[model samples]
Target: MRLLFLTNRANALRARISNTFTLPERFKGTVVEKWAKYWTGLVRDYKDVGVDVVKFGYNKPRKALVITGASLGLYACVKRNPDEEVFLQLLRQWNNKLILVSPTEQNVIAKEYVRDLELVLNRNTLRTLSLGFCTLLWVDLYSKDDCTYKAICEYTGVDYLKFYQYIIDIGFWNRYWRLDWKMRNFDINYL
Candidate 1:
């Protein structure tokens, strides 16, 4: 199945540890092996489930898309939209899905993103966009920050964290992973 995994790029706005220190400056005099390993671990998790994960660079298409950042990566994909059909095509899949594994902190741009998406994308399409290709809404989020998390809950009205707990209760991820993997083999237009 085709899957798109979008996460924060190191060059993203928050690349710096904070305003007080830049990313490079923060990592100065230290090896980045552990940092690399953390991302590698996320990739390995997908690999463990037999889903291929890409780093949001390069020009390749997967059967499913899994984006993890609420900042730039999410903004870029949403801005590109169905015109960037390669990604949109994957997003259009019945089992096509999106996941926002974002930091709790709010960025000004992200606030605007939520507003823009709500204004432009129709409820059905937004729900469909939230759902994968299966004619259902299937968006999910994993966040620890309360303010932004609360904002997401208010916007989607899904009580994301609670929903996630329920998913865990039902083993949702594993089942969805398998279902999506099977769904990935079909044509994008097959419906």
Candidate 2:
């Protein structure tokens, strides 16, 4: 989920959500509602895939993703480099993930990430809403065979048998791979 720019989506992912998904529902017949209705299905797709969005989880795999995903940012921040785009992007991704998991997860977004988010939202309703929306979209489009997926698996030190079992239990992994997915049905032991 932390992989930057997960999909092009014709560069419309921002418009699809900030312009609609995260907004409170309007009248049923309103144009916004219609657009939101269409996005609801797609947005929901990413959330169910189960990848750790950015770096928000309290588990090993999640922590690994954060460490690996934000490595560049962390390095840049520590070095006090003049250009900290990677570090800034890391903050934005982490902060956005926090928004989606909030009310239980404490928000740790620094002033910088807030400014970055504000710049993206352009003074729209609730920056948190857009952050949450973007977070879901990032995870939604993740595929098991993608290079990012391999990196996460390598970092997580995934047990093929167990990971495959988890996918089967959940009605097939959110996204399949070229390798055979046949696995005996069994209870999952996920991290």
Candidate 3:
């Protein structure tokens, strides 16, 4: 499988539980220490926990894909890169799996993904509601209410946030990967 790290900052790979995952602080050597440790630890973590995302295709090989973005780019990563045809073509060239790791939301958008999502909703809601609606749709469409999600609800009692967190941290995904630290420094640009 191939690993894809898509985010605005490459530094995210080193984030820990409480780190902000932004530029190095540059004070008292905080950024340097964090960066060095983050990279080293991540290499170890990926080796241990099986990485956050893995790509699986026709069972040939494995590869890695990493993308960085500030605001709007994050959105494109998830909603389907605007030049999806090109991306799809590129993805097909590799025998390895396609793993994509990105923040849950994006900053700027072309509105096409949103429009398509709106068509799926049964009611007349603003585009902003699409995120929640999509989450619901995923839960329903995946029948997660009865499977893993149900288990999450039964145990955590925190609803989707916890469920989503669980999935992100589950160490099963290979393509779409997100460093746990990105949750903190997430900008409101695309999301």
Candidate 4:
């Protein structure tokens, strides 16, 4: 499966994915070794699991997209930041499946960001642009110790019960390495 990883910063999520899976030898030297060197670039022939890494500010085309630190991107775009166009373009091109990964703190920030954007743009335009992907999945990477279904509902705008159904909690990273397993088992039928 071809995977495109979109992040707000360099090596943030790529480092995690690299740690979880064993990349091929070519990628070991070019991508795995020089990951820090690239803010946005393609890692071709990433073993049997094809993977590409790109930062949010970069203007690159991708099919199936996995957005890590999605809340940060949303915040930037909503605030009319430097990369707003890039973010809009990325969202416009997202026709295939999309997975958005964010921590609790960022998710809250994104909720506020979206609220502000709603005031600036037409509701339909914002909704169609942001929530128009074929298969959109929101994955919460971090939750508070006392986090509950209601908390997630307030934070994500998803219904309390539907929040559990849609969001993929790979568990805390400190608990164990679960991203690889979840990613491997991810249903890519939309792709």
Strongest candidate by lDDT: 2
Per-residue lDDT for 77-148 in model 3, tens only?
Answer: 445422323322323432121112233432223233333333433332211112311211121222223355
Residue 46 C-alpha lDDT in model 2: 72
Best of the candidates, TM-score: 2
How many Å off is the CA of 15 in candidate 2? Answer: 26
User: 1 or 3: which has the higher lDDT?
Assistant: 1
TM-scores of all candidate predictions against the true structure: 0.16, 0.18, 0.17, 0.15
Q: Tell me how far the alpha carbon of residue 57 in candidate 1 is from the true structure, in angstroms, after superposition.
A: 23
- lDDT of all predictions: 0.38, 0.39, 0.34, 0.37
lDDT of 2 by residue, 1-191 (tens): 32434534523665665666455545667887888678766766675453344334535676777777798665544354322233235445544544554333343333333454455334221111112112111111233444565445655544545543322111112211111122111112222
- Clash pairs, candidate 2, are 46-140
- Cα lDDT of candidate 4 equals 0.37
Tell me the spans in candidate 2 whose CA falls farther than 4 Å from its real position.
1-30, 49-79, 83-191
Residue lDDT tens for model 4, 123-158: 222221123212122433233332656545656454
Candidate with the larger TM-score of 1 and 3 = 3
Q: Please state the error at residue 69 of candidate 2 in Å.
A: 6.4
Sort order, TM-score high to low = 2, 3, 1, 4
